[model samples]
Target: MPDIIQLLPEYLANQIAAGEVVQRPASVVKELLENAVDAGATSVQLIVKEAGKQLVQVVDNGSGMSATDARMSLERHATSKIRSTEDLFRIRTLGFRGEALASIAAVAQVEIRTKQPGQDTGTLLLVEGSQVTSQTPTACPDGTSIAVKNLFFNVPARRNFLKSNAVEMRHILDEFQHLALANPHIAFSLYQNDLEVFNLPAAKLSQRIVALLGNTYKEQLAGCEEVTPFITVKGYIGKPESSKKSRGDQFFFVNNRFIRSAYLNHAVLSAYEGLLARDTHPFYVLFLELDPKAIDINVHPTKTEIKFEDEKTVYAVVRAAVRQALGLHSLTPSLDFEGDVNFAPIRPLRTSTGGNSFGSGGAALPAPARAVEFNPDALAASVAAAARGLSAAPKSARCPRGPPSRPAASWRPFIASWASPCARPKPKCRPSRQLPRCLSCLLHTRSRPKTRARSRWPPRPWQRPQPARHAGAGPLRAAGREVGPDAHRPGGRP
Candidate 1:
């Protein structure tokens, strides 16, 4: 019992910690990309192979670390971002936990080639499963290039838990988009399986969004900005019509770091309550800037969830800011009774056909049709006259002969009788000399029966009727020879 509580090995501890930091290839991608950004990298390149199961490399033109710093960076609880407990509460940079590299190295084969700007040479270090295999001097660029290969190599269980290539790549793209969106001033490029997926240059936030998503966003974006002593919210919100059925387009960044907050999300959505459909979500990329001490980012290992000291105040400000932006841009609906209802239609611009003299000289083309002015009074008079003429016509003259008394109500029944040759009545035969006159009269006048009432428009068809029901038996029985259930048996009679 005395030796039962032994200390865990450094490698084992780091591997266990890796469970929190490196959940999947996308997690590794996130940690590495943030580290590159924290190093003050202005230009970064990300390359992945086999959806990061085979390779995930990040090259950054940032301030590279010294040889000793590079070696210690892989040690647990060692970091250059913060120095004391108070520094943790006032944190401004990303990746301050110092556990990212240590945890990553514990589960994957890690290689780092780094050199400072003034250094004539560089240091190349390789570690396998948290064990440093080699460290040597090499000639390389004045930056850092870290490649994490064979992720979860030693942990078969973790490796097997990874999703398919398409799914993993989507996660990787999500992480990439988050970083790229948070830092518009930094140029970022991504290559997957030797194929260039994104090549974004340093630009403004609006331009960066258009470049990352597509040029179609250029017209859909509406600027949002609000400033106060407590906080400042600034970003872009898409037009109402641009809302999507999917939730992928929404983003919330606090103090320049991507985060997830249902409370804050509800605030933004409340601002767009009636503007979007129930199933649709509006596109927003909003950033909240406030004092770091007012919020705690250490509440989670991923740091995507934070607690604000004044959550309600922040919520109110965000909601109001979004609403104001929508109103200021005229994105919200409005009514104007005095506005003109008839707008001048725009004519299509004519193009030159190069044959006519007017077309060759770029002269104006003649109108295709004359413009007609609408007169309400004249239109009403013409409609009334047509109505009067229809009302004055005799009812008998409106329909042809050989039809029922009421043409409209009796057409279906008469047509059904005419369709059956046996039930139809034969037409009377006359001499050939009177055939033309009779045909003319039948075509000119409508024939109506003198009788006022009819029993049924058309008689029902004749068929073998159903049999009468017996007193005790179930319903009617068919008219056929009766047979018992055992009639088909071997010794039974028909």
Candidate 2:
């Protein structure tokens, strides 16, 4: 039997590597743009057709490549940025893996036109699916121009996985903004479907941000600069009031290379603890400058995520920088020098001048209150005089002592035998015709029914008087004894 394990073809190996490096059209655009910037290009232009599904091209005006170098650059693991393994620790430039160009050429049709400064002619090389089809010397301008066409043409499965045109365009725009922001001094322009989307000229970082994002960011930025022995944080942070609901405006760049770090982002958000609303993120374009050996940018395949040697220190520094910027610009939550109204000066209602108060014509203005002197002897004399002159209170009704439910066990025997004159029983009723029958049914009534039913005692003030069922019923005289004045329920006020 033949060996099951065998080496894959060069094209097959290149295609597999392409799956990691070239995720979508945005990945291709990122690689091409980075190469342009790394070439020391002062001016660069990007053109995309059909959201980079058909063609993605980058043109630059910097030092270009020669014919031989152009052909060699198509092979995997070919780069001039590093020499030895130690160089990986001090990587400062972007796109150093050397897999971008090779992987891109493996899945797309790539064309290159580049020329050095002293060269009389330029080199034009074309490759399709990792196979060189043509190599010739042509007349072209200085610097390099790489065009990638028919992306994922050889891999139908990968091509079918792409998103809509608008979504892909949005991704491509994101990569373009990152590269443009990373290099503020470099002039950059982007054209989608022959229509210009952004034409950012060489300018300062703030100006570049305003041009790239929107004009609304012009007055919202605040400068943030902090330098430490380990790291230096510098950039512009948006004012707290200018924060938005989405986090699309936040950016973190390490050594002029954009990256994503949630830990670092949290540090920034914490600085805006009470300033920003919940679920709202502030806009910031912070650049962290540190020794390359202290960070590892090669941790991720796309190099957009990095690992710091001491992340805590970096977080502290970033938080401090952002906080300083916010406080210095807004000067909010300041101390109110105006004293409290509750402690204002008070004036006496009656003035000391002739003891005059505000009256008809003698309306005298109130005088400033004066402090009272303490006199213990005078206070004692006044207390004695008031006690001697006090009058006694008039006697009223004496309330019954026992509980309404029943007398206490200690007083049961005494209360059982005790009897008051007012509570003496009346003689049994006799059917007398005069006095209309004493309304013991009516307590104190001259006219009442011959036989009245006993109503509830101590009538509730809220109940209405019932109409007479017979001919001679009237007033509270028809009801039982009047509930004298019970003042227990005032207005229920505290």
In the order shown, what is each candidate's alpha-carbon RMSD?
18.2, 14.8
lDDT of each: 0.83, 0.81
- The lDDT, on a scale of 0 to 1, for candidate 1 is 0.83
Model 2: per-residue Cα lDDT over 1-494, one tens digit each: 97799899988899999999999999999999999898999999999999999999999998999888999999899998998989999887897889999999999999999999999999999999999999999999999999999999999999999999999999999999999998999999999999999999999999999999999999998999999999999999988888899999999999999999999999999999888877889999999999999999988889999999999999999999988887788634656679675676787555445545656767566665799999999876543333222111111211122112332345433333431111322332222223222212122223332554445656554433544454333222223232222111234111
Candidate 1 on 73-142: residue-level lDDT in tens? 9999899999998998889998898999999999999999999999999999999999999999999898
State which candidate has the highest lDDT.
1
Misplaced by over 4 Å in model 2 are 1-3, 337-494
Candidate 2 clashes between residue pairs 3 or more apart in a chain or in different chains? 439-442
TM-score of each: 0.70, 0.70
